[model samples]
Target: MSSLWEYANPLKFMRTTDWLLPIVAVAAVVVTTTGLIWGFFFTPDDFRQGSTVKIVFLHVPAALMAINAWLMMLVASLVWLIRRHHVSALAARAAAPVGAVMTVIGLITGAVWGQPMWGTWWAWDPRLTSFLILFLFYLGYIAMWSAIDDPDTGADLTAVLCLVGSVFAVLSRYAANFWNQGLHQGASLSVAPGTRMDWAYKAPLYTCMVGFGLIFLALVLTGTRTEIRARRMKALAARERMA
Candidate 1:
């Protein structure tokens, strides 16, 4: 934690992350491309859902990240709240757009897939409704960040907002328990041993997921760097004014 805190300064962050971004960027592109090819061509059509099921390659990972990104922000927000770490606040802010993007992807893909299978593009089903609220919450959080003026004020406000948002993530899970009506089936890719593996499908799905994860990392790092620079400019301007 102390080591992380030491790199909170903009200069430190820029210096440390400078060399790594390009490497990650290239890897992300390659992985995503490979995944798409494998998913679209190599993976066999599902026996039950047919070709539309390929959307799972996109939908599942985005949905997983949508929820996990908030959890990441929640942890960063907690760090900021408890220890007053500016980088933690900046990181929480940085994560907002990525999470929002993931949520949007999940919503759109889910709708597209749902229409053909369920005969409706939308549903009041618990899983669908809960995920929708998650999307809305992402919008609201980003809106709040944009609305505020001062960085510290924005960070504090958004930190509180992120904290509030974390509670609702439960909807992602509780949607199943509360309503007992869900459009989504239970997980097909279970981790338990002896779980059936169709190598062709699993190969592409895992590749896409890895690719998406890399892309997400790249986005978060870039966003954090931007926030750090913006803060520095603000500080320098204030110092000039004071001097």
Candidate 2:
């Protein structure tokens, strides 16, 4: 356990991420570019939805990351609370904007797809409403962090908010299934036999999902590094003032 905690040391964390970032960044660029191009051009249009169906390549992946990013933050927050790990707290902080961006992308793409399929750009459907709520949670989490000047205090406040918001996030994920009447379609990918999405659409979509996840990791690592540098600068400035 103590050895595992060694990774929480800022110097160790920075040394590891310095090497890992470039590789993750390159992979994110290559894989995401490939997946987006393949999905947009190579894949056939849906019989019913036509060209607009291509938006799923963007929408679904962003939506998946939107939820997963918050989940990641929640876990990071828990680690910070339990272990007093600075890296974990900063990781949760670094993830907020990325998650917010993903949520916005998901919502925008969803709206665009909906206009053609559902005959409206916006609705109070369960899925849409829950997702909006999730976005608001992201905003709130970010706001809470910014509102507090003390880093530790900010982390504590936001971590509590994240824990509370997680309930709603989980609700957002299962809302469509529970309601069963939303215009939004059900899950595209599944593990059960014969229920999975067709490979024609699924292949590029899954690739994009992986790419998005990698991109999220890359962004978090970059942002966490920046936070660490800023904290070090602040501490140095304080020490200089004392001297």
Candidate 3:
């Protein structure tokens, strides 16, 4: 536990990420590119959905990261509130835009995929609606952070907002199950041996998922380091003024 908390220090965090960031970035690029090429070009067209099925390579991973990123922020918010760790708050802030971008990717890909199947570009489906609301929450969280002058105060308020928004995040994932009447389909990836997706699709899909996760990690680490550096510069400027 103590070792884990050591990363909360800005210098230590920066040091650790210095070596880790490039590896994650390179892995993300390689894995995502491979999965996309494999899924799009090499795979057979679905008998029903045809080539449109290839969009799942982008949609599923983006949707998964969209939700998971918020969960990551929620955990960070809790850590900041409990431990007063500035790094945690900065990390949550860093994650918001990444989550928002993932949400947009999910929404756009979903719309593109749905048009051929659902005959419409948009729907008020349970899962889609909740995911949209999650996007709004991400925007709101970012706005709230920027609106305040004091960093700590902003972090506190945003943490509360994160707690409130978590309800929608939960609903976003399970809303289809609870409502039982929605245009959205069930999860594409599953642990069962005989899952809905064939191994051909599942294998590349899994690769994409891992790639997206690493991409998210790399972005957050980069963003958090930027924030830490900015904070340090501000502190130094203040010291210079005092001197």
Q: What RMSD does model 2 have? A: 1.5
List model 3 lDDT by residue over 106-223, tens digit each.
Answer: 9999999999989999999999999999999999999998899778999999999999999988898889889998899877876767778888898899899998998999999999
Score residue 98 of candidate 1 by CA lDDT: 94
User: lDDT of each model, Cα atoms only?
Assistant: 0.83, 0.92, 0.93
- Give candidate 2's error at residue 49 in angstroms: 1.0
Tens-digit lDDT string for candidate 2 (1-243): 348677799999999888999999999999999999999999998888889878989999999999999999999999999998999999999999999999999999999898889999999988889899999999999999889988899999999999998987787788889899778878878888898566889999988999999999999999999999988887898899999
Give lDDT tens digits, candidate 1, residues 1-243: 457777767677788779988898889999989998889877788887799978988998788788888888999888888888888888888888998899899889988998989888888887777778887888888898889988878888888888777876777746676766667665557788876658778888889889888888888889999988888898999999999
Give candidate 2 misplaced runs (Cα > 4 Å). 1-4
Q: lDDT winner between 1 and 3, please give it.
A: 3
Candidate 3: misplaced stretches above 4 Å? none
**Could you give the candidate ranking by lDDT, starting with the highest?**
3, 2, 1
Which residue segments of model 1 deviate by more than 4 Å?
177-179, 193-197
